[model samples]
Target: MATTKLTLSVDPEVIAKARRISKLRKTSVSAMFSRYIATLEESKQRETPLPPMTKRALALAAGTAPVPENWDYRDELKDILDERYGLK
Candidate 1:
């Protein structure tokens, strides 16, 4: 594949974190940024609400044993999946 180099300024802390993650994953910073940018662009195309989930409802769903007032089931479900898969 053809490639090109481009330079841009970014926050130092963000670059440091990206570099750390890139090294941990054995990939180049450019590649990591490319993937991240691609995902962000893709998300921009989505039109749905992406499943509603309030923070208080999420806590109850995780078996936190304290269902906050006006809890919603959607949050509970998202919390369950996030916990099981470490998606967070």
Candidate 2:
């Protein structure tokens, strides 16, 4: 892949720390920043295609599992809140 050089302005203290870390790792600061950027890009690429709530709704619509006959979502939510707030 083609690479380009870029200039960055940073605090002297931060630059000094980065230089120390780079020396300890036996690599240049540029390589460290490159790896950091690659990691961020990889995380973005690996994101879920759908949000959890939407996925659950889709599964329910598709009848993946039967809803419980006595299920009360409001009561379930209140129970969850009570548990979370130590009210129960």
TM-score for candidate 2: 0.55
| Candidate 2 error regions (>4 Å) | 52-88
**Which lDDT value does model 1 have at 61?**
81
Instruction: Give the least accurate 10-residue stretch of model 1, judged by summed lDDT.
Output: 47-56
Residues 1-88, candidate 1: write the lDDT tens digits.
Answer: 6889999999999899988999999999999888989999999888465345665666558875776799999999999999999997
RMSD of each: 14.5, 10.4
The window of 10 residues in a row where model 2 has the poorest summed lDDT is: 58-67
Give each model a TM-score: 0.48, 0.55
